[model samples]
Target: MAGGKTINSVFRRLAEEETIRRVQTGLYDYPRYSELLDRTLGPDIFQVASALARKFKWEIQPDGASALNLMGLSTQVPAQYLFHSDGPTREYQINRTKLRFKRVATREMKFKQPESAVIVHGLKSLGPDHINDKTIAKVRDWLPEAKRRQVLRDTQTVTQWVRAAIREICKEPVHG
Candidate 1:
């Protein structure tokens, strides 16, 4: 429609008809239903966040705990999914699950490779003491060959200690 009034009217109609479910103000989705489970299934939080980021023209990356969870390094599912962005801070709740976006400096959001960024965040979440040889091996094993190479190539932009850890993780064994 040409104006907010027209758009709101259309949205109201669709919502009333159950064709769309309102997640929050200005956010909506086609509600997913699990027939076997007999309950509503929540939308993929990452996909929802990505759509919002694109719609608002914001650059975002999964933050700390969220990064660890996305990388399978963390087994516990977080109640809130967090992201860092160059845009204003905002929060949204979808089906009782929370999505939080915290604003940060542009430089903080820069990374040559997304996989490297996730690994760095995950390592930071684990802290120095926890990121030993076994942790390095686990992370290396978790990543595919291409992503392992990319992480190695992208380590230059990270901190010295982090780069060292990444180097060790990427090191190839010498055969006798």
Candidate 2:
């Protein structure tokens, strides 16, 4: 219940039923679903390379957090928000916070977590580059010291080509 008014309670309940607990009210706790995803792919944020390729019906590699690991930017999390898709690739931003999504293919949509779904919309809205260096650094700093190197190494896997495309999309100044 991201501290919203009573009017939001009903939605919150629905979200919770979907394992999408309100972090405040309109906002929700996507991390909880991340943990669940680790245990089982159900109700996740659809944050995988194969998943996005399937969902968007495009052939694009991940570029942000998912790619960051490939780019030596950071190690992998037991589960972290994913990047990619047909629309736009970016972290969800609202009121200075970011929403996370679990990657999933179009066919796999049924398994995506309810919380992650809303958050993914936020990221899609932000577009790629929504996760800038500052945010990457923040994410890097947030992880445990032991995981820093691995994350950096993993982030390195994220190539600039896709990142540039995503940035282009984000910089488009367009919204649907």
Candidate 3:
């Protein structure tokens, strides 16, 4: 901790002993293991991103693709875990996977409800043409009761079309 050399030496020893794993420069975690799977499991991408955002005092949200994936609206795995933040753009490689943070407008980073933000971003990734009745039903089924209610309540702050789409997804039977 006294100097870069000392820190590197300490980290290297810890890694070699499997006491801790390096995530990225100056970041480390105690690795998690699944006995049933008989393999190591990586840290949750969103949790890692949230930690980094807090460390740097930045507002952050998952980007469209990441949001879709996070909400189980998309089955495709992303090559990179992406987030939009008000901080400067940056990238990190953790356990051979890329984590990217792209700078975005202050307004885009603000959301009063987490479910609304995730649903909006996930719907944006699907696009209007892809969001049919079946898609809306899937999203509705995927969301828990409380989150469904919250998304409906939070729709007031979103744009007209987005609010309508969210209302439809929540199965409110009326868009207002």
Candidate 4:
């Protein structure tokens, strides 16, 4: 394993050269410049969370609100990007926004991909009573064919109603 001092030294030099921007203590990103916006874009919160999970060797999934926001199912911008993880619960501040990891059951982290996590969590957030054909169709249309198929396969063992909703979302269009 690399020494913490050695890693910190490298990061300090990189930050000094502006090769990377520090999101918070121990988290850094190669800042993305947006020509359209004429400025450096903020670090992507999802990418930041993923980086933390990888660094800590944690299995992570976006929680309901975060997942809904990711899928465009919710219009409200989350003040905190919340994730359920096998790691200890913690919070990190990224500028005005916050990133949180809440420890959850292992079963919840079974999704094979982030896309699958988003679909499942988003549907769960909506709840059985709130979901309708329109919502299902919206989710179906939002995902590409490949992702729809993958998400369908990954969520087979999820909660029955959520699984049912995923089936509807991922079902292929029938031709007459």
Candidate 5:
């Protein structure tokens, strides 16, 4: 009638406009995020750790022994990240990796990871005996040479706590 457009066409346009508004405003549910999860899970351990930490709502630092293993300096395997969290217990089994998520005492919390990055930190996370001067020298080459001296200088301070902890954990004699 008004320029020859029909009333039925006007009403149909209005209905589509409402549906578009609802979808844009999040009135519809999409399961596509699960596909994202499926794509990221299992093969990517660190990604899974990050996702799991958020899923459980915790503060996490994937360093210590975890970094050492990823660095190829340690032959031993890590059982967990020793995540110092204010959250409850959570255990994530990502393929062969076992990540432990548990509550930590406030005093034990860390603000900065020693190795900076997760993979680097895992390489340095070994027991006291496992991190000898030779082992340290071997792993040092992996870092930029400029950083090696500083990392070596920090080793005494770095492994001090780890050495003490391993001794206490094993309840046995300690070695360098």
Candidate 6:
């Protein structure tokens, strides 16, 4: 019964009544309305992805473009938000954007904190050549002291240059 028209009809009724909005196949969300924007705001891509991951029991790490955007290092919103996952590779269309999960080795998914994962992937994407004091400072200033320290500890196994960059970001501030 759960797999038949019963469940489908329930969802169809909910959608028809505007109680939930369909995001993609087998996904729905309580729509949020924005008064200033004067429209139903689009779903947050990360939240949607996280929802899917949780539903399907997948571990996901935000890829470079997603990390950069989430960290405020990039002004452009990626048309395709990519994530590395310890799950089957899959894609979903959310609004006008694409959410993709690329399968990877489970080892790559290891990180204690989400922030640490974001920082490491963001740094790897930027590469050693592009990392500098300004970038390090930007990341440092974004994190509270405690979070910076936590990220430092959480990212001990990352690449040498990324680990170095994190060390610089997590270092104590010098007072004159």
TM-score for each candidate, following the candidate numbering: 0.73, 0.23, 0.76, 0.79, 0.44, 0.81
lDDT of 4 by residue, 18-92 (tens): 899998777889999999999988898989999999999998989889988877788887888989999999999
**What is the C-alpha local distance difference test score of each model?**
0.82, 0.41, 0.81, 0.88, 0.48, 0.89
Whichever of 2 and 6 has more lDDT, that candidate is 6
Higher-lDDT candidate among 4 and 6? 6
- Candidate 3 residue-wise lDDT, 1-176, digit = tens: 29989989999999999999877667778888999999989877887898899889988888889988887878877889889889999998766678999999988866767667778888887777787787787778777767777768766777766777888887754548
Q: What overall lDDT, based on C-alpha atoms, would model 6 receive against the true structure? A: 0.89
Q: Residues 45-159, candidate 5, lDDT per residue (tens digit)?
A: 5555666667666776555665566556665766555554667767755446677766776544433433433323453445445655555454544455454434443433434
Backbone Cα, N, C clashes tallied per candidate? 0, 45, 0, 0, 10, 0
TM-score of 5: 0.44
- Provide the global lDDT of candidate 2 against the true structure: 0.41
Q: List where candidate 3 sits over 4 angstroms from the true fold.
A: 1-20, 34-37, 172-176
Ranking by TM-score: 6, 4, 3, 1, 5, 2
Cα lDDT for residue 54, candidate 2: 56
Better of 4 and 5 by lDDT: 4
The predicted structure with the larger lDDT, 2 or 5, is: 5
Better of 2 and 3 by lDDT: 3
The digit string of per-residue lDDT tens for model 1 on 50-76 reads 889988999888988988887777878
**Which sections of candidate 2 miss by over 4 Å?**
1-12, 16-18, 21-56, 70-73, 76-91, 94-176
The lDDT leader among the candidates is: 6
As for candidate 5, its clashing pairs are 64-125, 65-125, 66-122, 67-121, 67-122, 67-123, 68-122, 68-123, 68-124, 69-122
